[model samples]
Target: MTRLIKYAFLMSAAIALTACNETLEDIAPKAERQLPSRVVQTMKAKGMSKTSPVMMRIFKEEGKLEVWKAKQNGRYDVIASYDICKWSGQLGPKFTEGDRQAPEGFYTVRPGQMNPKSSYYLAFNIGFPNAYDQANGRTGKHLMVHGACSSAGCYSMTDEQISEIYAFARDSFKGGQREFQVQAFPFRMTAENMARYRNDPNYDFWKMLKVGYDHFELTKVPPKVDVCGKRYVFNSEPANGGKFSPAASCPPMSQPESLLTAYKQHQAKYDFAFNAALKKQSSSKQSETIAGHSEARLVADWSKRRARGEKVSRLPPNIPSPTAVAEAPEAAPTPAVAATASAYTAEPASRLQTALEAVAGEQQEETTTAATETPAAGTVPSPAPRPNTSPERTASVPAPEAGSQGTSLRRRIQNLFSR
Candidate 1:
């Protein structure tokens, strides 16, 4: 009787364990179908397997998304480029929850962040309001690079395109790439491009982003990014061998000497070309002034109208259909051009541009604000203090001052003018 009782207990425990395992499996997202043949072929051509680690770079102005795969040689190569079907807001970093601006910054994606069973076909969170965004008191949620080819404040790709992109990320994760970097930029960080927009209010911010951009360009490896003094600092180890603190003053640091030398040389060449480009552009056209109510003011006005029960006349911008996009030849990878002057591509005539024009026509009395204003030199303010006891930090950092909350919102709106 004792032997029989022991056998029954062991059998019951085994059944319970099996049931628990099954329950876990049931909750997991279903395995996706095999990668498309084209994607497979492209991976092979680029000397990458399905499991190769990847990095992505997005350019808002160019409407392009580039997938770079790590090669056997330990360098990343551009494996594919897809046109962004749609993106919202303008060419600037997103600040507020309802602003409808897709973000522009460095982000990371981990395996658990993937949503294989997504309403938008498939999706991956872009991990917005990152350390830098949080330190600056930016706010938003559910910012994603996803399928559906439509967006309110996300990077939208065609369903087909996203499937391929998603598969690359999924396989990379499976191959033990714990996280991959996503670098989103307002525009290609080229010397000529920078020179053309040098007077834009966001020029300083773009210059800062260019530092990371240059790092990748020189080494074909994503720079290790950290934040300090409320700005991004890349690819250096703290002199005292301590962990970097985003809101703290950056300690003395050093980078590999060869990498530093290469970067300096690249910058020298870029500066020479930038000067020539600036001179040529200045001679050719008077600076083209953007004549319109900035997107922020229009959004604010739209909100007011809605609250008052007025019918809004305009609709959100429409994205091009997949068929329409397929007919156009793929945009060639932008080549590094010499210092000789070349004309920048004119901004496309899209619904967003038309809306800006309409708003300008109506709000002629509105004061024009620069895209974003630069803080006075040598005025790096310390971040507001917070309790260090919490293991899980809050997404929203405390405002520097009670009154500064309003000031921060105004700055965000002003920054939208650059878009």
Candidate 2:
């Protein structure tokens, strides 16, 4: 009886831990463990090993997550590009807990970070709040690139995507790779994008990130990341042979002169392109502003035409001037009010009497037409525009005044033509 009890206890423990790892029937590990045929074929074609080291890069604005694998030459090549299903927050780094921000920086992912039986299908923490983030006093936790297409301060992907990505990491580990790198950015660090975003509040931080970006572009290898004096310094080691401290002053360091020379050449070309991009953008904004003002002026004329029940522009214009409706031969309330007023204000006293007569005729015509109309069922007819009474202001067809009266008159007389 004592021996049986011990066997039962051991069996219970196995069942309890089953979900954390594979079951007995899962020993083959082919479908779940091996890379897919296409990917394997790609590896062979690219001269990469079956289980080489992997690196990942993310672009939040572009919603792309790229997996890169090391080739035999110690350089990296693109293996896969997955579309991120969701990532929260704007184009900036996380500031505190619950900011819902997917962080941006260089991060390391060790073996312990992988989660196979995740509630989100599978996941791995991207290791946010790295040395630089810490030195700057940023805070957050459990930022992951996970499946289930759900994101809350995490980078999320579909279940299928995470499965493949997880396979890459797993196989790399099986081949004795210890850790991988993740470089996250707001967008592709292009010269044009840099020029466009030069004035953003986060530009200084992004400039720091570009050092690593430039390194990879030059060498096709992930840069060695270290933080010192609250900044990221790539591929440089302290001459004094001390470990880097996130918050301490950087020691004297040695750097590769060849890499520096390549970077300088790259920067010079980038500078030229960036300046050209800025000029193009500046010119674009000026043209839009000019067009916007012209469009604004079109609205006034369009409103005027609608009030008088005349056909105007189908849309606002690049220029505002006398509308076709204003020049149309006839509408109940003709633009004669504006025209007559303009003529009277400029001509002699004899013309004032004639202009007043034209204005009176126009007002009478509008009033008579409105009074004769019948409103639809379940509706009362609009009250007719009042008849001209005072000679000093015989009729006031509100000419774009600023109050509610202006609002009522400037808006179109709906269904006026059908009436």
Among these predictions, the greatest lDDT belongs to 2
Model 2 scores worst on lDDT over the 10 consecutive residues at 410-419
How does residue 379 of candidate 2 score in lDDT? 94
lDDT of 1 by residue, 272-388 (tens): 999899888876554333423344343344334434444443322331122222232343111221111133222434544644554444333222321134346799855644553
RMSD of 1: 27.2
Instruction: Report clash pairs, candidate 1.
Output: 371-415
Those runs of model 1 whose alpha carbons end farther than 4 Å from true positions after fitting are: 1-31, 286-419
Q: Please report how far candidate 2 places residue 231 from its true position, in Å.
A: 0.7
> For each candidate, what is the lDDT?
0.74, 0.77
TM-score of 2: 0.67
